[model samples]
Target: MEINKFIDHTILKATATEADIIELCKEAREYEFFSVCVNSGYVPLAKKQLSNSKVKVCAVVGFPLGAMSTEAKVFEAEQALKDGAEEIDMVINIGELKSKNLKKVEDEIAAIKNVIGDKVLKVIIETCYLTPQEIVIASELAVNAKADYVKTSTGFGTDGAKMENIKLMKKAVNGSAKIKASGGIKNLDTALSYIEAGVERIGTSSGVSIVKELKG
Candidate 1:
C-alpha cells in the first residue's frame, strides 16, 4: 500500500508557528501525503503554501476541547473553508453527549455539515473521554448527522485511539461513514495496524517518519 496517501500530516499544537506550518506543507508536498491538518487560524497560510501542490488542507474546529457553542464551531468551520480548508475535523460536545443530550450533539454536527455541504466533515468524538457504549453511540450520532468520518481522539485527550475502540466504531458506523484514527499514532506499525483494522485515514504528526519507515 502507498501508506503516505492514507496519512493526514498534522500539526495542531497551540505552539505551532508559521514556520512550523510552512515546514509541514513542505514535507507534505515532498512526501506526497494526503493532506496537511492544521488549526483554523493557519488555514490560509497552509492553503497558500500548498497552493501549487496536490496536498489538501484540513482545519480543526472545536479543537481539543469540545465545549464551544455550536454557533462558534459552525463559524470556525465556515471561515476555514473560505480560507481554503478542504476538510474539517470537528470535536463533538462531550459534555452534552455524557448528559445524554443526543439530539443536541447530533444537531451540532449537522449544523456544521449543513454549511460545509460536500466538503468532508470528520467528527472528533474524542474516544478517550467516552465509554465503550458511548463510543458506539457517538459514532452512530456522527453518521446520523451526515458526517463523512467519525474520528477517534484529539491527541490532547488522556488517551488516543485503540484497537478495541476502532472495532466498536466500525460496528457502530455500520458502513454508513468512514473512520479516522488520530492521536498517539506515531509509527509505521501502529498506523498500519489501524489501516489493517479498516480505518480510511490516519492523522498523526509522525507521517514523515512512518512513510520513511515504510520505505525502509
Candidate 2:
C-alpha cells in the first residue's frame, strides 16, 4: 500500500510555532502526505507554504475539547475553510453524548458539516474517553450527520486510537462514512494494521518516521 497517501501528517500542539508549521508543510510536500493537519490558527500559514504542492491543508475545529458551542464550532470551521483548509477534523460534543443528549451531538456535527459543504469533515469521537457503546453511538451519529469520516481520537486525550475502537467504529458506520484512526499511531506496522482493520485515514505526528520505516 502507498502509506503516504493514507497519512495525514499532524501537529496540533498549542506551542506549535511558525517555523514548526513551515517545516511540517515542507516535509509534507517532500513526503507527499495526503495532508498536513494543524490548528485553525496555522491554516493560512500551511496553505501558503503548501500552495504549490499537492499536499492539502487540514484544520482542526473544537480541537482536543468538543465542549464549544455549535455556533462557535461552525464559525471556526467556516473561518478555517476561508483560510484555505481543505479538510476539517472536529471533536464531537463528548459531554452531550455522555449525557444522552444525542440530538446535541448530532446537531453539532451536522452543523459543522453543513457549513463545510463538499469539503471533508472528520468527526473525532475521542474514543479513549468513551465506552465501546459510546464509540458506536458517536460513529453512527457522524454517519447520520453526513460527516466524511469518523475519527477515533484527538491525540490529546487519555489515549489514542485502538484497534477495538476502530473495529467498532467501522461496524457502526457500515461504510456510510470513512474511518480515520488517529492518536498514538507511531509506526509503520501500527498504521498498516489500522488500514487492514478498515480505517481509511491515519492521523499521526510520526508520519515521517513511519514512512522512513517503510522505506527501510
Candidate 3:
C-alpha cells in the first residue's frame, strides 16, 4: 500500500509557527501525504505552500474542545473554507455528549457539515473521555450527520488514539463512514495494524517516522 495516501500529516500544537507550518507543508509535499492538517490560522499558509500539489489542506475547528456554540463552529468552518481548507476535522460537543444531550451533539456536527457542503468533514470523537456506549452513539451520530470520516482522537486530549477504541469505532461506523485513527499512532507496525482493521486515514505528527519505519 502507498503510505502517503493514508496520511494526514498533522501539526496542531498551539506553538506551531509560520515557518513550522511552511516546513510541514514542504514535508507533506515531499512525502505526498493526502493532506496537511493544521490549525485554522495556518490554512492559508498551508494552501499557499501546497498550491502546486494535489494534497488537500485540512483545518480543525472547535478543536480539542467541542464546547463552542454552533454558530461559532459554522463560522469557523466557513472561514476555513474561504482560507482554502479542503477538509475540516471538527470536534464534536464533548460536554453535550457526556451529558446525554444527543441532539445537541448531533446538531453541532450537522451544522458544521452543512456549512462545508460537499467538502470533507471528519468528526473528532475524542475517545479518551468517552465510554464504549458513548463512542458507538457518537459514531452513529457522525454517520447521521453525513460526516465523511469519524476520527478517533484530537491528539491534544488526555490520551491519544488507542487500537481497541479504533476497533470499536470501525465496528460502530460499520463502513457507512470512513475511519481516521489519529493521535499517538507512532510506528509502522501500529499504523499497518490499524489499516488492517479498516482505518482509512491516520492523523499523526509522527508521519515521517512511521513512513520510514514502514519502508526501512
lDDT of 2 by residue, 1-216 (tens): 689999999999989999999999999999999999999999999999998899999999998899988999999999999999999999998999999999989999999999999999999999999998999999999999999999999999999999999999999999899999999999998999999998889999999999999999
TM-scores, all models, native as reference: 0.99, 0.99, 0.98
Please report, as a residue range, the 10-residue window in candidate 3 with the lowest summed lDDT.
Answer: 207-216
Residue 86 in model 2: shift from native, Å? 0.6
Pairs with steric clashes in candidate 3: none
**Candidate 2 residue 26 C-alpha distance from true site, Å:** 0.3
Model 2: runs farther than 4 Å from truth? none
lDDT of 1 at 153: 94
lDDT of 1 at 104: 100
Give a tens-digit lDDT track for model 1, residues 1-216: 899999999999989999999999999999999999999999999999999899999999999898999999999999999999999999999999999999999999999999999999999999999999999999999999999999999999999999999999999999999999999999999999999999999999999999989989
lDDT of 3 by residue, 13-94 (tens): 9899999999999899989999999999899999999988999999999987988888989999999999999999999999
Task: Mark the 10 consecutive residues where model 1 has the least summed lDDT.
Answer: 207-216
Instruction: Compare the candidates by lDDT and give the number of the best one.
Output: 1
Superposed model 3: Cα runs more than 4 Å off: none
Of the two candidates 2 and 3, the one with more favorable TM-score, higher being better, is: 2
